[model samples]
Target: MRNRRPVGIWLTTVLLSSGTLLLSALLAGFLAVVSFRHGWVRTSPLYGIIAFLLVSAIIGTLLSAFFSKKVLNPLIALIKATQQVAEGNFDVRLEPRSKGEVGELIRNFNRMAEELSHTEMLRSDFVNNISHEIRTPVAAIENCATLLISGQLSGAEQREYAEMIADGARRLSTLSRNVLSLSRLENQGIITERRRFRLDEQIRQAVVLLEPKWAEKRLELDIELSEVTYEGNPELMIQVWINLLENAIKFSNAGGPLIVRLSEAGGEALTTIEDRGVGMPEEVVGRIFEKFYQGNPSRAAEGNGLGLALVKRIVELSGGRVGVESRPGEGSRFSVSLPMENC
Candidate 1:
C-alpha cells in the first residue's frame, strides 16, 4: 500500500564539482605556460605543460576517488540492500554515512527496513496465533458434534454437547467479527457521516449496553458526563467508548470502582475512563495498542487483542488522540481527547 518516492538527483552538483577541478587544472596549466618565459622553467616549455598536466591528473584521480566515496559507495550499498529487500528480506539495512538529502534518504531507508522487518514478524505471529485460536474452537465443536451424534449419549449429555457446540460457534463468530472490524477500521481512509451529536449521551448509551458485564462483576460505575458534544462518526465514537468501558470492566477486580468522566478542556472533549483493575507493566503498556498484543497473560482468552487497536484507529481517524496511564497492581486510566472543532 506504500511506494518509495523518487529521490532528487545529485548529478548536477557532482558535475559542477568535477568541472571546478578541471577548471582549476586548466588555470594551473595556463600559469605554467606563462612561467616558461620567466626563466623559472628549468626544462622545455612543453615539459612544464606536461608536468602541470600530470600533477593535475593525479589530483583529479584523487578527487574522483573522493567523489566516488561520497556518492557511489552508498549507492552500491543501496543496490545490494534493495536486492535483499526485493527477495523478501526486509532485514536489509543501510548504514547512514553523511549529511544532507542523501543522508536523510539513507536514514529513511534504514527505518523502512526496520519497520518492514517488524511488520513481517508481527504478521507471522498473527498467523500462528489466529490459527491456534481458530483450531481450539473448531476442535471443540467437532468433538461436541461427534459426541451428540453418538447413539449412546443420554439426554443431558446431548444438551451439554449442544451447548458446547453453540459456544464454539459463538467464539468463531466473535473472532470473525473482531477481525472484520479491525480490518475495516485500519483500511478506512476518512471519517464519514460527520455530524454534531451529544458525545456524553452516546457514551451513556454505550455504558447501558454494557451494563450486564458491570452488573455481573458487582462493579460500581461513577459517570460524570459534562454536556460534551463532538463532530465525527457517532457509531465509531460509540465503539470507542464500548471498547474502553468493556476493557475497564473486564480487567477490573470484583467490587472495584469504575469511573467514566467526560468534560471539555483546552478546546477538546476529554473522556477519561479509570478502573481499579489488574493493571499492566511498563513493557506491556507500551505495546498494548498493537494488534493481537495482550499484556495480561492470565486474561488472554478474554479478548482477541483488537479492541484497543480499533479504538486507537477510530480516534486517530477522527483527528483525536487516545492516551493510557497504568501501573502493575494499580488501576489504569484511558484518556481520549477529541478536538472540539466549531464548538
Candidate 2:
C-alpha cells in the first residue's frame, strides 16, 4: 500500500506517449515516400533522418503540454480542494469548468461543502443553547440555596425560597429528561410496541391533561374527532399529541380559539391542531422542528426546545409525516398524517 503517482498524470502521459509514437511513425513513412520520389533520401538520408527526428520531438512535446493543461490541471485543483475538506475546511469550493463527469463531480463537491457548513453552524448553536438552558436553572438553584442557608428569613420567606429552589430543580430535571428522550428518538429508526388504540381518545386525553394551562387562559376549544383506531406504539403516539397540544396551549392568546381535529380519508389518518396564538413568520415556521430551535424568544423560558423535534422524530418512526402552517398574526396549524395500515 505505498502511495502511487496520481492516476490523471499517469494516464495522460501514457496516452500522449502512445499517440506521439504512432503519429510520428506515420509522418516519417510519408516523408520518406515523398523524398524518394524527389531523389532527396538517396542523396541526403542522414540529414533527412535528423530533420524527421527533430520534427517528431517538437510535435510530441507540444502535444504533451496541451493535453496536460486540458486534463491534469482541473484534477490537481480538485485534489487540493479535497485535502482542504479533509482538514476540516468546509468552506472550500471549486469552480466547475469541465463538462460531463468532471463537471458533475465539482458540483456535487460544492453542494457537500455547503451542507457541511450548515451542519457545523447548527451544531454550534445547539451547544450554545444547551449551555444557556442548563446555566440559567443552575444559577437560580444556587441563588435560592444561598438565601436558604443564611437562616435570617421568616417562615413565609423560607417557604418562598424553598419553592423557588424546587421549581429550578424541576426545570433542570425536565431539561435533562427531554434531552435524553430526544437523543433516543433521533437514533431510533422504527416504532415498536405496536397496539390498536383509539386515536380520538388519545387526543382527548392529551387535551384533558393540559386543561390547567388552557383553562387559565380561558381559550375556546373546538373539537371535531372521528372514531379512528390506529395501530402504532401508543406510548410514542401519545407523546406526539401531548407535545403538539402543549405547544398550542403555550402560545395561544387569552380567550382565543384552540381547534383539534382527527379524521380519516384515503386510507390515511390526519390530525390537525390549530391555535389562535402569536404565530410565527415564514422563516420561524420552517425551522420550528429543528432540535433546540426556539423561534419565539419571548416565550423561550417555558420549556426546553426539544419537544417538537421529538414529536417529529416519533411520527416519522411510525411511518408518518408532520407539517405546519402559520402566518405572522394568524395562528399556527400543525398536521400529522399517518398511514392507516399497520407499520
Query: What's the TM-score of each model vs. the native?
Result: 0.72, 0.80
Candidate 1 residue lDDT tens string, 1-343: 2344323335644664578578767866897878987888777777887788778877876776677667766776776687778878997777787688778988998998898999899889889878877987899999998877776799988888899999889988988888887888778888988888999899999999998999999998899999977788887889899999999999999999999999998999999999989998889889989887888777876777888988999999989899999988888999999998875
Model 1 worst lDDT run, 10 consecutive residues? 1-10
Best by lDDT: 2
As a whole number from 0 to 100, the lDDT of residue 36 in candidate 2 is: 72
Best by TM-score: 2
Instruction: Candidate 2: list runs displaced more than 4 Å.
Output: 1-40, 151-153, 187-189, 211-224, 253-259, 274-287, 319-333
Instruction: Name the weakest run of 10 consecutive residues (lDDT summed) in model 2.
Output: 1-10
Clashes of each: 0, 0
lDDT for each of the candidates? Answer: 0.85, 0.87
Candidate 2 local lDDT, residue 30: 71
Q: What is the lDDT of residue 294 in candidate 2?
A: 89
Q: CA shift at 159, candidate 2, in angstroms?
A: 3.4
Candidate 2 clashes between residue pairs 3 or more apart in a chain or in different chains: none
lDDT of 2: 0.87
